[model samples]
Target chain A: MALPGIASFLVTIGTLACIWGLLALGLNVHYGYTGLLNFGHVAFFAAGAYASAVLTMPPPEQVSQANYVIGLDLPMPLGFPVSLAVAALAGGLLALLIGSTSVRLGSHYLAIATFALAGIFEDVLVNETWLTNGTFGMNSVPKPMRETLGAGGWQVAYLAFSALCLLGVYLLLDRLIDAPFGRLLRGVRESEDAARMLGKDTNLVKLKSFAIGGAIAGFAGGLYAHFLGSVVTEQFVAGVTFVVWAAILLGGVASSSGAIVGAFLLIAFQQSTRFILTIYGWIQSVLPEPLSGVLPAIFAPLPDHPSFVPSVRFIVIGCLFVLVIRYRPEGLFGDPNEVTVMGEEE
Target chain B: MASALSQFLQAVAFGLVEASVISVGAVGLTLSYGVTRFINFAYGEFLAYGAFLAFFLSGAGAGVVGLPVAAVVAVLLVGALGVAVSRVFFRPISDRGALPLLITSIGVAFILRYLLIAGASAEARQLPVPLMRPVEVAGVGLTPLELGVVAVSVVTMLAIHLLLQRTMLGKTMRATSGNRSLAEVAGIDTDAVIRKTWFISAAAGGLAGILYGVLFAPFRPTFGFGYLIVVFAATLLGGIGRPYGAMLGAVLIGLMISLGSTYLSASYDQAYAFIALVGVLLLRPEGIRGGEF
Candidate 1:
């Protein structure tokens, strides 16, 4: 319940919002524009984190753990940019591997395949310790210019850098979505048969969007790794995928601005909820029920149990997902037509 | 070579046990999907509920009378839960389509999982059955409990087959699942059929959960949820919406998973089924069972 000061606060929530905003935008490109459901978008996010971490991390021999492989010991200058490029590449290639076969199956089947692929990806990361270090995860990542900027200053600088990157991505996506390519994506989404009839390489177009979205996800992942200073296999749970999906649905699936708004809104919702929980926790601690213990016991099984808070958190988000789907399929910022993701329901 | 062959055979034997669990679930999922036309991801939650119901029943000292009494009550209870979910969350919002329905299922899954965490300790629980001495067959050690699990699953499958094929309600279910509009025009209540389908499917899933609890030993709320990918693959592998396809596909997938772990690294056993599913979809997007296309 110790409140992080202003600088730490912005970096904590702000950097995360930016990271997730990038992911939401990546998902928006496919689910939003193309109507392709890339259900396992988290795979690319993991890919970016691993790629960046491996490039910058020292070889296993250099450290006590030879548990994972492929560290290059590159300087921040070389490591950071290369990591981005690798993230983009890994994302695209993975998308290609998953997309080429499953995209043909259409949205429903593709959703299942991508979800499974992400699960399989997690298993690989968890079990194949030689590669992903088997769940212990990679740690002690050197933040860019940490020596010069100092710890707190580096965090602030990273937050600024993240904001700038997000802005660049937003502008870039806006232009892309407004262009002819974007229109083509829309066509592919609404009615692939019609697009195919029109002589568009419909499959090819879908594949491109899938790969591009994945690359963006990778880019986001790379940024996340640098900011986080560690990469854990647990980071890519399917819940994270749903959160991004919620973001796009909440913000506005169709627009870049909407994706940004949705990401911020989702994070704010999460943070505010946590703050409320913290306040309740303080209240419970301060006031004894009948004697004070009664209230805490009534409210939470063991007030201090870590799972208690997360359980409440999950309940809130689960309810939110249901309500959002029910009331605002188009989201707060989206155009009415942008409600196409769940449009078929009605 | 001899060791490898025996290991393979041993895997097949174990796979049968795994397949029995998956088949019951697959049948339920396919039957529900047939009319509902949405992937009921929360179907896995039914398994957890069923397992926990029995777990609690035994905890309440239903030990000797457990299998018949406690399990039946659990199945019926979960069936009712399915009906309630169908009426409450799904029916009102289902007008949307597959994506919303799918998302809703995920929401329901979260709710069930968190609820389980809140209600039951997150730690694993035993089914309260005593360990039996292992029975050896062809150099493979099998337990009496394992055989009983398979026997129970077979009886359930046969019962379902009779319901689907012989009984009037079963015939009605078939007609509705095949073509809802046609069935409705013929004065069959598609709504009633859907309700029944949801009930039967959920009950079947609960039974599968109990077997999984007994056979797998020491399970938690997330037990069935973890196997969802394999179950989905099984359902789709046999083709979606086909009445019998789920059972057949589940058997194949169960074999693949068990044998894969035996032969390949156990770490990627789950991936094998997923890979098989992708392969099947690529070759036959309509599923292994041809329908509607």
Candidate 2:
């Protein structure tokens, strides 16, 4: 049932873009809304996925063999809810711990601490073979309604589910941002000392923001895990964190729609590059050997190699970050007047 | 019991060797932070570039010219990179706030890493330098390579200390770090001091990278990325901008990692480092040796 033409590919990319957009929105709550620089948001995502997967596991032995622990053999409908809850719980708790310890530190210090903590979690995932099965990862996790509904139906159902989740999250965030609590958060984001002097408990506000942001990230992670049908440590690496950060930056940090917009643009750009390179390669095949070799590397090879793509992605994404920071720190959707604190503007 | 004791002693010695390399790198980080007032995410890339340069040079038969000469070349190359980066990236954002500078540094780091990947093969390359054979002391084995690293690091630190205390350039650097405006007003060439700081810091980082490559034998393009966090933890623990504090922090980190690996699973070694860092931040946010936050 292979769909022909670029339309199918475009649809596939659009779907992923939506997911990434949702993830980025979660990140916005931390970086854009509250002005917290979290470098370990991916950990929450991983935790969500793993928790969901483990919650749906059959037995101890089965989970062990699968290198995951989803403890129950329930249907995806039930499992999905549990996964989200588990992720939020875990993420919130971890955020609480992290916030309690380092939220009082400056923004930069908090960022580094989270970054280091992310690395430690990754290390744990890789080394704790008993828990995570080292690096081989878990597979064969059932998708929602895959057994009852056909592939197409499952896809449609999942897409709808994801949309609902995204909508719910966005609305909740919108309401939160409009409320007095959101004002307090924005207040702290603008000037922590001033907020403190105004009798606001800045630390408590930061901790709450961190916890909520982490919970949102965890919820997205659960969705991603279920979609992939398997979870790996690679998915939660610092690189993914950076990618989400990039998306938030591109969309407009404080703008809700910016998160979705940035994710769509980034994913579309990435996929389009692949398509363009493939076409270039086809054209190069017709040319003489000497000319073919001289063509840009993108046109010369299809880059079927996984490592090549990731390395190139890093370079490109890194450049994008630099460009955005230098020329468009406001991001595409961000308020021009809302300057980033922590030394960039002032 | 005796075997465990021996193992403990062996771990300490190995940890010391590891700490020496880390101290070298952390000092570079501390120095840059001390003067510039921003964490250079590209600091790890300096180490990476230096090691890669040495790997290429040694492969080109420069080792026959002697290890010291090859090391000097590597250091010089990395120092040049640091100077260039500071001039091109840091100078433009010198007056800008911290986050922008941090982001710019990240960009610099990203560019260096990917450029290395593009230029060199993605595969991990073994450095051409031969590891000195291991020698035993008190029923515990130690390698000449490790011993050499410790000696060189100590010498470098001592020289840096003296240069800071006695040399005009070092004094100027110190003065600038202490008060850039006052130093400028006092007829000090702050830019020259910054350049010198970048040169020494990057050279030290490069030397550390080379020593690590020599000891570990091989590394991938992203090898230094993993160590960046650990280095930051050390820097934080040692006091953000104090060189000696970095050394002490490195030692503490090294000991924790080595001992943790021995007692618990090796997988938790890095986690132990993170936990220790968190503890330090909670208990002593100013670090063991206080510095300007």
Candidate 3:
């Protein structure tokens, strides 16, 4: 690969890492710090992405070729900040709505209910074609300052901008977690009854954390839409929720820096799997003939199977998740004390 | 007016078939939840594996007798696998309460599902069961196979009822589910009861999967996972951890899905289930049964 090619590849991965880092941070607010199992975090993310996409695209009347409903046609400069704001507002409102009902359930029941909520949200995205363009999704999402900066320059600039967003969220969360409110969250997590005894309205505290986490997820979603230049319902699958969950789990639950590290590591792992076939070929070339023959026999279907790498990657990710939970529940950077299974306090 | 009535009847027929599958799955889920105190997100994989295992077996062997044998063996093997899975992955962390156990189950679900995808191609496949045309009964058109699914479902539910009520093991199992510590204090080997519960629950799930595969045909690796939401809806609607509630929930969900798809759009089948679930959760969080299993 050429130098610029490698650089661009790194840049692209870095951009995605930042997006996922933001997502992980959002999840960390729920699971890591507040101990809220918001399994449907992707709902807020999708809400923000579509909200931003709708803001940037031309009005339905202006675009003869468009499929979706509710386009505002704002320019990128105006659209960017507005989209993020809209996304955050949308997400927070949604959290308050969902949290009002679901936040009262037992931890596992809440998880299941939220999972269904995400399904319902995705159903709306797919069925409400006029709103989300149905399955086709909205394309040509306006890139901020794309014309001013060349394509390459835009990529670099966007990378910087996304990194800044990640850093800003990180700093914000860092400060937030150290505040008196953060202790209240910990108090709620460790023992809601105890917090209640202290005159804290634990449910209100939970609702607040959920709304803030949801807003962060919404912000990340908007950034993602701009970076991908599109907002497809497919991007907000259950897998995205698990990926963020895995990232937070890997990074050490509740640690902002851990979320970023976990996101980068997972994205790198995913990218590395794209080269599995090539790596396999190299391994085959270097191995002795008999060993190579045996290896092929063992992995006979891999080379021919187009989805082999993705399957392996998911299997590995799943295994890693289980192993971490079983052996290292606190994760790489999480506090050992905080590793207590949720709902134990009850 | 007659055509509308018949159409409604036809939808009912479809609902019954769908209900059979959902009933079995929900029962398994509720049963496991009753004993385990955690929702197994990976429960869908048992259905998937069961259907696929039967498909592969029937495809690989004797023509006439293969399907029945395959179905039996698939259910048994899945039941055995359930025991092994719980013993290996669940028992250690079972003490950690519902959250860790639930998360682990999701991980297991992903691993099993993708392994199935990797091992079996994404291309849809069907079991080698003999095809029969639809037969009419009481102004409703249903194939003999669909009728068999309902029969099997009823029989299975009856058997479970008998086992829970009439047998010593059933009594012990119920006792354990009600209070494991109390049961252990009473000299009941709760571990054995739990293992038995896992077997029966997974076996029910496996049987449901096979029936679903037979009726739906052209099933894919993602079939069970996709259907999981509906199963969850049914389970929740019936009331979690209540087998009887699950059965009732299945009937309602099945009718809702069939009628909704008929009158509205087929694409929103799962959405309808979600609506029903949310409505139930909001109105009556205890579900229709509103009590312990």
| TM-score of candidate 2's A chain against the true A chain | 0.88
Score each candidate by Cα lDDT. 0.82, 0.78, 0.86
- State which candidate has the highest DockQ: 1
Per-candidate TM-score, chain A: 0.91, 0.88, 0.93
Better of 1 and 3 by DockQ: 1
Error of 3 at B189 (Å): 1.5
User: Per-residue CA lDDT of candidate 1, range A207-280, in tens?
Assistant: 99999999989889888888888889988888888889878877877878888898998887777666666687
| Candidate 2 lDDT by residue in tens digits, B1-293 | 99989999988887888888888888888888878988788888888887888877765444554566777898999999899988877787677688877867777787778777866757787776565667997878887877888999899888888887899987888888889999999999898889889999888888888877877767877777777877887888998888778889999988888888888878686777788787777788678987542
* DockQ score of the complex predicted as candidate 2: 0.57
Q: What is the overall TM-score of model 2 with all chains considered together?
A: 0.93
Model 3, TM vs. native = 0.94
Over B57-166, each residue of candidate 3 has an lDDT whose tens digit, in order, gives 78643343488899999999999988988998889888877777888888888888888888775768888867898897767788888899999899999998888889
Candidate 2 residue pairs that clash: A53-A70, A54-A69, A54-A70, A55-A70, A56-A70, A57-A70, A343-B97, A343-B98
List CA RMSD, all candidates: 2.6, 2.8, 2.5
Worst 10 residues of 1 chain A by lDDT: A337-346
Regions more than 4 Å wrong, model 1: A1-6, A272-277, A284-305, A340-346, B1-3, B60-68, B291-293
* Candidate 1 clashing pairs, residues 3+ apart or interchain: A288-A291, A288-A292, A289-A292, A344-B96, A345-B95, A345-B96, A345-B97, A346-B96
| Candidate 1 local Cα displacement, residue B246, angstroms | 1.4
Query: What lDDT does candidate 1 reach at residue A36?
Result: 85
Give the Å error, residue A249, model 2.
Answer: 1.9
